[model samples]
Target: MTEVLETTSGSSPRTRMNKRILTLAATGIGAAGIAFVVAGAIVFGDFGIAPDFSARLAAPSWAHWFGTDQFGHDMFARTVHGLNVSLWVGLIAATLSAFIALGLSVFATTCGRWADMLVSFLVDATMGLPHLVLLILISFALGGGTHAVIVAVATTHWPRLTRVLRAEILQLRHADFIVVSRRLGKSWWYIGRHHFLPHLLPQLLVGLVLLFPHAILHEAGLTFIGFGLEPTKPAIGVLLADSMRYLTAGNWWLGLYPGLSLLLLVLCFDAIGNGLRLLQDPRQAHR
Candidate 1:
């Protein structure tokens, strides 16, 4: 009986190990799907070249997974390509915006009164303008497309980032370590890199993740309004826009799939940001 019990216990652990492996395998596939979306655009010419004309107008099934658009282009292919566009815009725009904010915050902390006043005035002026309108105007002025979308979104959101970073820096400026660093005759660069930056990192990282959702949504909005990535690029917004024309004719798949995909993608980034914030907050960790 003792030998039998040992065999049973050993089998139980093997079962648990197998379960864990299956769970990890599922997660790995999900991650691969995300990567495939981003890489599909560049690698397969947005998969536009391989679209099946016969698959066009087909409903979702075992064969044509996401169905087809009115033009017979595979919705699945377009959706994957759209992910590439969103990911690129979100990453580049968020980074550029964060840098702009960091620079402004540092300048406010280190620069004299006159410079601060000037920057303050500029930030306020930009803030006063309606953000979406400003983005459209900027995009139009810059002739629209990927680079324009990136710059427009980054610049428009930067004022808020700057304000937050500046406030954080101001709080740190009075800390004992900052006072000591100042007394030691350290340069601004040295002080910023070795002292202030580490303190600001937690907040900066949280802000970057939060900004990704915004950047992605803004890019989609611009595309929906015909000012973002070109029509040929197969971005989500463009797909939705194209579907709108045919929605009244009973082709719901065109708009429905892309819209759902966009919502989920945005929600994923938002969830990640919220999770990061909670993880960083010691008070929230145990609760």
Candidate 2:
């Protein structure tokens, strides 16, 4: 019963040109962001944990570009390491969130009315609460560590993506091919494996990438509030928290550089996600 829309034979010249421009822009931004992360990791990885008591509290100089912390550790190194940690956390958390969304979405669309209703209710309930508060509570309850932060981020971040996926799946459910599959006596699992899963890949990838910034920011926030990674770890939140007391004494570089670094990394992640979204659009690829 579903009506199918046919694609046009070709795009206009202007449209093709526009698509090429967008595709190029997206690819460049994504590649630049990825390169920055990799370069930072390789260059600063070794200096992360080493401390120099003789250089303690030293301001930024040729020897230490980002200055020394209260413990004489290189701020540049710590910031880079912290970024590496945040990226890893974001990657794992986003991947887990995507999987959760995919499962809930598939279940809601393919199962009976009661199952759909259950998923809908759960999504609504989660969205109703304050996201940060829920994340903080979850992290705190789990005893506040790296693992706790990852779990909190993964659990709190899935609702939006789940709703999006559910809508996508519902739309696909009524598609002509899906209707044909059902009439041919194909099982829900078979149809999902052969049709729905393939269709969902693009959305899943975009959603996963978009989740990175949120996960990194939230993890940093939680740590800042004393509900994230341990103080011993050189996390961005830990760095910021440590620098707070020194701010009154006019030691600006301690916090400023790390804060800027974190902001830059988050922006890079966002750009990469946006780029990937554009690249995934077939219409945008032709040009």
Candidate 3:
């Protein structure tokens, strides 16, 4: 009788490969769009190589990859520029929000009651308002523009991150490692910097990734409503708003392309976030 042997193989390699592919696809598409935007902005100006308003709307052709808008602006160029705007808004807003939340969470965890109440009250108040309305109000109050939009988005986005980090810190504070660290005569500040911060990083990273999509959409919405970047500027929201004008005249490319791009960008970030969440949990990964 032939001897039969069972072999075991680790799933690590497969997992890594999947992760690599996911990263490549997400990063490649996003980066290509970003590079296109940047090149357009630097080399061809914000609206790309669009013609004047006199050209009328044109369909996609070799001469015009994505065609021209009513103003004869290249739709492709405008879309690319919009990508830059969204990317910056999302990235900056997420970073600023994360930092603000981190500060608040650290204060709450270290300073105890006073910090906790202040942070809680602030977050609660912000949460009680309609987020978009608040964004609009903030934008208007700050003299609505690109910088104002970034500030407004960051201000509103941070509170939830603060709450999440606070919860995570509270849970980790009672962990065995933390308890042992305390017993070793380590100061709170020292423990937080060396021990607590490390534990909190993964959760914060996940939150930041998820928060980006919201920031991007919020910026777009604000822009769409005339409370965001300048209309003359090449922003996705502006492109979207402009598209509506020509949509009834069979110029569907104006609206449909940018909308699709926005949808795909948001979906990509969301997918990456979900993937990261699953990667963090072995059970979820297996499932």
The lDDT values for all models are 0.80, 0.86, 0.82
lDDT of 3 at 153: 94
Off by more than 4 A, model 2: 1-23, 283-287
**Tens digits of per-residue lDDT for model 2, 1-287:** 11222125355667677766765676577568667766887877677587789998889999999999988999988888888788888899989999999999998888888989998898999999999999999999999999999999999889999988888888999999999999999999888789999999999998998898899999999999899989988889999999998989989999999999888877776666666766787755654
Show how many residue pairs clash in every candidate, following the order shown: 0, 0, 3
TM per candidate: 0.83, 0.89, 0.83
Q: Which ten residues in a row have the lowest lDDT in candidate 1?
A: 22-31
lDDT of 3 by residue, 195-236 (tens): 778878877888998898999999999999999998878899
Candidate 1: global Cα-lDDT? 0.80
Best by lDDT: 2
Candidate 3, superposed: residue stretches over 4 Å from native: 1-50
Comparing 1 and 2 on TM-score, the stronger one = 2
